[model samples]
Target chain A: MAKAKLEEIESPAMLEEFYRQMLFIRRFEEKCNVAYRLGKIGGYMHTYVGMEATAVGIHHAIKPTYDYMITAYRDHPQPLLLGTDPVKVMAEIMGRSDGMSRGKGGSMHVYDIERGFFGGWGIVGGHIPLGGGLAFASKYRNEDRVTICLLGDGAANQGVVFETMNMAALWDLPIIFCIENNEFAMGTRLEYHAADTELYKRGEPFGIKSERIDGMDVLSFHKDMQRIVDWTRENQKPYWVEIMNYRFLGHGAADNDRQLYRTKEEEDAAMKRDPIARLEEILLKRNVMTREKMEAIDEELTDQVEAIYEQADASPFPDASEVYDNVYTDMEPEKGH
Target chain B: MAAVEVATQTMSYRDAISKVLSEEIEANPDVFIMGEDIGRYQGTFRVTQGMFDKYGEKRIIDTPITEAGFTGIAIGAAMAGLRPVVEMMTMSFSILAMDQIINHAAKIHYMTGGQAKCPLVIRGPGGAAKQLSAQHTHCLEGWYAHAPGLKVVAPATAIDAYGMLRQAIRDDNPVIFTENPGLYTVMGEVPDDREFVVPFGKANILREGTDVSLVGYSRMTQINLAAAEKLAEQGVSAEVVDVRSLSPLDMTTINASVAKTHRAVVVYEDWKFGGFGGEIASRIAEESFDDLDAPVVRCGGLNVPTPYARNLELECIPDVDDVIAAVQKLG
Candidate 1:
């Protein structure tokens, strides 16, 4: 995707906002990594280090607090962009009482029902049909809302994904099937995992208007997503769009052996196209801010992320009395095993 | 209980469920039914016959033969404030959607910290028919009851099925409503009132006796009732306790029966080794050991997969004779 000319853009400040959002996510993920090492965050914590552009683009494209969204385990950035408190998100990761999910869901299961973000589902391709269902309800109730369902390239091969797309197209549900094709299904490379590596074509046989695009450039990605969202909203149809990107961190906090699948040479090549650096260059060319000013802002965001971690760490763990809570809304399960 | 004057009519088990489903769909705008072959084709079991003509396409949505997809779709719809009744062609087919049902439907409320509730009902016929063989004949209420966030109920009679189906539709959590295929044609008196709703976690004593407690649910309850008749002929009074709901298990009623009877025989059509019957038996041993005059015996289905042949299928399924034999062994 070619960069839009600065003259063609109406607001240059939005570009600066995009840079800051990506930078904050980067710093927040880095802090989560340190917290994981320090035994603060538990379970499989997947960071949004390299895929910030995709999430930022997705976050900006939808109607805040109106349109629905659902994604797989690697979820944090989208909710943060949608105005979820960073302290609650961090507290959820650290398994604290006042966290997003009362510390029961941990890192992979953040949910903000008030914001219309359905969940942070852990099962791969599990939430795809759920996304379709949200849209199905929207259309069923004659409501004007779109649901964006995100999945990984690995989850692309799940049978439920195809099943959902077929129904979404057949029923004309207002939903966007967004595939974050980051190329690695856990550790297995895409070429080895998928029969046909062109993941977007999975929706083509169903006659969905599908396309593959570059998700690295946040500005272009946001514009393209906005167009897709409007088309689905107006037409009440489903669109399958594959956002191609890369993950800079390991698959999760525990993935230490990088040599098993990828090489440093390929890693260096991907790093050169670092979305944060590329956006930073755009900001500099446009005179959004000087290098010193950017450094100061980065320091400020770093300190802000540190405070988020500390505030989350200070939050108390859930009381033992709540272990049986939420099992059912009105009834209790046979308590204590 | 006050003896209020209410009209009751005899209806088939299938019609009882259809009556409740139609009533709920008409009563609540949010209530809808979705499944494969449930629209124009009715249902594979014909449980939804004529429902499409009444509700039209939107309410009685026909889905692709994708259990996981539609199941998850129903869960999502439930999360968004719709009450969806998803009919599995057979409870055996629910295995294909276990990940969605157990992981998604069962956990959405708890995992989301009470933010989302999956108010959906997954209902269909279960257990062995004449020739469904191994794959099609599965009593899986035992498995669903094991999940924390799910409500599993297998009603044996048409009245209980009618009353419980209403409660399951109005319930705000995920419910696994399993009806045995063998009992769909069984006729019984069901109340005509739409207000009739059965509460869960309560066991019903079908027959009052003192010798032994014949405990079962779903189709096994019918078998236990038949066994009670034979036990009565032998001058033994066997108390039949029908465990309607399995998840929020009502030990109060069950242990009360065992306490009165002093001996118990848990009968289930599910495999004997790891079935929910074991849970009941263990609970009785732990909580009612002092009341027992004999050991708690469990007469569950044979461990092997049910065969297609008439004789072998009969061998695998626990029947009245099996229940009687198990009660005899309780001494």
Candidate 2:
């Protein structure tokens, strides 16, 4: 059964907003993939095609100002969901001067401190302790701010993750550890990698409150996440949320080899459980939105994506002279002591 | 009349660090300390004693035994506009936090193109102590000094500890304060004025001499000074220059000293291979090659894992004899 909040939020306007944002993220990512294919975007291009609900659902769980978020390399949706303009995010993926990072950080290194979204770490399980540290500071400062550290199922096996979980439990720091368990990390299955595949139960030894949710259902994700986020903010401790999700595409644009490791039958089965499809089903049944309204929202998003790509394409790259700036503080060392 | 400021009486290195932390914490709202057993337990070495009782629990946080986790937290907090003072218990433990130190703290400013600055300090006791052995007894300040992003400070005296720590806390970049366990109890006079902040990368000349320039940091600075005193008795004037900050190295002062004295001896307490002394030697040899007296001499601990035995621990580190021999060899 869904929670009261899920039942309460039956407004068509809200549904339209959700569809708009989710469609914007999906279209922007698709544009980036095309841009990368056309050589306009360089380096890695990891899209969030089918995992929009995990980003959209969790984005609704906590206030952006009070919560810090750190994610792994598959990170396009986070900046978008964290109040970043889809166009600027698209420009950042294109590596232009007008990008959020001023063209310095590509996809995996996006940082927007103003929105409390930390950089996208390329190293696996590396930012677990980092997120734990941010929460420690929040508790120390007596601020209600909590850090939401997102990692893949692959990163769950890292020793530092276990170390951070133990420490987070010991310190009672406010942090929400969300594992986007998309079944396969690149190519390896969760069960193929670890003996015990369940991440929520893995937190039992550390005494961290853990939960498993059907990540494909946006309502279930939002409701379940609210409980964990509330528990974290109230108790000022760590909580683990393992979101069982699936990515519709390969790991990156370059991985067109078609992930043969996982069966197509499994992929099709998970696709039928797609988050967007599930949300549309609920919206239609509730009569909050029709197919024509949903189509209009997507069309508006497609135009928005096109406008962003055009702006990003025309935007200049950073001049070579700007390379040496910002390595250190503006203040020079004071004269002889 | 300017009140002839009485030099606050001599204080131990431990007390000096406490006083520095006290004054800085009082003056700056940006500063706070975090580490395992720092609060309530009042720090394992008692460096943070009475801080919890004075400043309350929020400022002096006791974290779980997670160096990497807590260190990353400090780095992120630093990025988010708070100056955090992180204690690692020992330099050995800092290895676990290297990802945060190297990747995040060091790279963020450059990686983010000036949108972020990590005004953070990671400090704790370092170097060989009795019976702690292989893991705990290693002096790895050189490892940190090897990094380009961090400002590495290894204060040798009570005054330097007090002054450099204040400077480090105020620095806009990340600083690694490497306090040696061996010298934490050594007593010296520190300025009473809380405004005293020793600038990094400036070598402090403990003794002016016409003979070889003896360069060292932290505990080895004391050993060099001791050897200099011994040499003074035998009519050999040893110029003791403490290279306070290792990263923005005071190569200018070192090169000038070697140009005048015509010879130099570099000493450290870490393993000899890729030791800090090796860097010093290369710098001097490269810059002061024409002004030759003898080859640049290097002295450091033997290349081996530190043992638990007291005598072995003592043997593993460079002593006054080793300093004297290096000075004699330079001559």
Candidate 3:
């Protein structure tokens, strides 16, 4: 899982774009924590703070039309990278009508069908089979599309995951099982949860090509993912990626200041390899962006976050009648079946 | 109402389902079938007999023995604007995919603010037949009808089977169309041209009467009809309502009939306690409370796991005798 040389990026524009997107997500989650604590954004918010690079890298590696995604509750970065309006996402978090899910699905269940991002599932391991199914359809229709089904280490324990893996492998579905093995499933450490902590080998029984990569480095993640996606796309075979990553925030904003789950030494050890800080270091060392340019990008993202907050604050809460609407498509029945 | 025209050609219930599937697939490219043992093997029950030869492997998929996986895939494909007919070899197998059927397919359309609609149909044989014990025999249409987001349809006759399946395939919402294994061999006339489609939420008044209204769906509809004839012998003119669609239940039809009949007996093959009968009873009680001259009696299977013995299984299922008894009690 060695990091790629900075010179490998032919154009610094793509690298800068990726860095900015990752930074925006980081800052957006930070703002979400502030808003959530102040009683603005309510109900279950799982932040993708440390695992931004993994999502950003893989999301950028494929076309939106050809690729569909389903992930666990740690999902804020996905919709943003998939081109959902940031203001709408913020508004939805605030339970406003303008939100991505029209205030029904707050933090966890953001869905953008137009953008080809299916949804963020709250139930662990529930969407694993769904992701596989999406890939199965792609291959069945001869669409030449691949679905990147993302999940955390906790979801890997689900029987449906293995069920889907075996079925996906047997069917030769064009799906990539992206496991963001962030070293912990909430408070339970990986060692305690999984017998063989190497999550990539979980795909071995299904004969799905598996790879373990340094999830902190965007370049490593992107390069490895590109290879896997291309292979899956060409061969229409399922593959797996075990991302060795960590989450900076607690399981949720609710878990803040509770260090009883882990020792301070372990927390500090993970903090030193902070994905954002490490990426910034790499950028500066490789001269992708000067210190001033990095500062400008940070300032721009801060302004965007502020604007998003303002827009959300201004948007109205969903109408009371909306609770009953949209449960089924209010489509008028056509003339014939 | 026009009587179903008796045609020279007749098909089995299994063939009716197959015809509906084939017609829908031929008419619309978006329509496809996916299930275990459905492709090269034709099907475990052979419901999709020549679908592989006609539509090829892509349209008639042979999935791994992963109900949850393929069901989920059907739901996803439906969301993406494909009409997917997912067959659970038996209702018991559907239990494995209940999460997707209930949570994803049923709830996603509403959860996504109507941006996604699952035009998915999960159809299969249900209920006790021969020696298939507790594990294999499960009448789950009642369970599915309880969910608000899904359309639950159980078509007993060949015409309703073909017509309702066509409707289910084209429905914008998720639908559970349960068939009966025992009824697969039941022969009935079917039109060659694929034009018939029964509307959802519409109940058929099999035999209009004034004494009592007997409600049933799927194979139970036939049992209720038989009971109605017996009830007539005892001077109880039982009006029979074949409830083809359960979720979007024709409350209008049931309420009107109860008002006229003054007494009702709900017959179901599902176990007692929280079965689909409860909903119908509640609806009748709520809408036509003053119309009832007698208490609404419910006739259903015994509330216990069905045993393997033929006699015990027969004892466990709601039959024509049970319907007669229930209607007599209403008198």
Candidate 4:
């Protein structure tokens, strides 16, 4: 996958925006890690530390309301980029009342329905068909909206993914099946699971257009995703883009047995292609911003993230009386079942 | 209740359910049906016969033999504001899509804090039919009812089938509507009104009596009614309660009936152990313990997978004799 020229972006402002978004995600994930260690956040916290460029690039390329997005559990950065309030997202992670899902769904299931962010489903490959269904709705309603369904390389082997890919191709549903192939599914490496490691080619059997891209390069990711999104929107067809990336942190907050599966040397080598650093270098080479200015922006984002975390931490927990709420919309559930 | 002068028409259970689905599709453009053989072949049992010609292929979609895929798609469509009624070939096949039905469709609303509504209906025949062995014959209402966010409805009579299905279609939550293949050919009077809807969490007292309360749903409801008739002949008046909705269980009606009758026998087609019948028995023990004159007896299918042989299958499921025996033992 060759890198797309940065000149494709007409404005240096857009490049700076991309850099800022990646920086925000990196800083936000770091804070979530600290908060998790301090017991401020509960449940599983899957950070998006290393895959910032892929998250920022793909999300930035799509129409926020017109295009739908569904992903797996590693999903905090996607919602943040899609315009969910950072404070509310942090509150959700902290299990507070003012959270995005009112503290009902912790870090794994951030949902912003108004923004067309479907959810971060907990089950692997569970939302692939759901993505097809969303696309089906768009086609049925005579709308050209596209749905981008994201899954990990581990989820690529799920039978339902193939099932959905076939149906999406047969119906020509406007969807882009984006596989965030971060090499390992939790601690299990791709080689141990999949016979064919070429994740994007899995769609070939369904006759869907497929490709692999360099996920660490923000410009290449953004350009390819924009093309795929536009093609899907115009043609009402499904496509596949396997974003080759890596996760720097452990799979989840509790996955401390990383040394059992991977080596420190491999981790260091992968982090050398750090998406944030690459984007920062690109922005500097293009004279988008100076090193001091970038540092100032990072400091500002750091302070902003800290303030958001404090606000979330200060928010009240959901009232005990409200536990039964939202179980069903039209009926009052039996109390104390 | 005053006697209303509304005309009723007799129809098969299958037709009653199909009528409600067709009516929903006709009334709402967003409503559609998808399942294997539901479009052209008009369903395996002919429940959707002629629906393809009437509504065209777009509305009556015939999906590939992918239960998990189509089910998840239907949930997605429901989230996108389309009312999708997905038909599983049978309840047994729904196991393949359990992740979608249980994990996704059932929890999407609560997980999203009520921002997303999965207004989807997964309907199909359940329980043993003829000699369709262990793999095909599964009464899974108990499995589905155990989930909190799902609405489980098993209507026995033609009228209840028609009315409850209409309600399920209009409901803003995911509903698992299980019909009995054994009841599909059973003929009964259903209201001709298209707007008729049976509300959930409400049980109907099919026969009013004051001795023992016979509680059941789906095919077991029919058996309970038959048992009630037998008990009547034996001078033991038994009230038959059809628990149409399982998840939002009509415990109020069961409690009231048990309070009057003072004896209860919960009958179901599911196995005796860990079956939905146990839930009813426990509820009765908790709520109407003081009102009970005798221990709450449960009459359910044998603790075995349904056999292919007719006699063995017959012995496996609960019949009218089993219900009567259980009620008689409660004496």
List chain A TM-scores, every candidate, in order. 0.97, 0.94, 0.94, 0.97
Q: Write the per-residue lDDT of candidate 1 for residues A1-337, one digit (tens) a residue.
A: 2346434442667777888899999999999999999998888999988999999888888898899999999888878888999999999989999899889999999999889998798988999989999998999999989999999999999999989988998999999999898889999999999999998888889999899999998888988898899899999999999999999879999999877999999899989878999888888887887899889989999999988888988999999999989999889998755
Candidate 3 is scored at a TM of: 0.95
DockQ of 4: 0.80
Clashing pairs in 4: none
- The true-versus-predicted C-alpha distance at residue A330 of model 4, in Å, is 1.6
Docking outcome class, model 3: medium
Give TM-scores for every candidate, taking all chains together and pairing residue i with residue i.
Answer: 0.98, 0.92, 0.95, 0.98
In order, the TM-score of chain B in each prediction is 0.98, 0.97, 0.95, 0.98
Q: How far out, in Å, is residue A239 in model 1?
A: 0.8
> Which parts of model 3 are misplaced by more than 4 Å?
A1-10, A330-337, B1-8
RMSD of each: 1.9, 3.3, 3.4, 2.0
By lDDT, the candidates rank as 1, 4, 3, 2
DockQ of 2: 0.48
1 or 2, greater by TM-score: 1
Report lDDT (CA) for all predictions: 0.92, 0.84, 0.84, 0.91
Per-residue alpha-carbon lDDT of model 2 for A1-337, expressed as tens digits? 4556555654677676666767777888888888888999888777888888888878888887558888878888888877777667767778888877778778887777778888777778887777877787677678888788999898998888888888888878798888998887777878899788877898888888888887878776777787788788888989888898898888888877554777788789888987888888888998988999888878888887899889888889888766656656743331232
TM-score of chain B of 1: 0.98
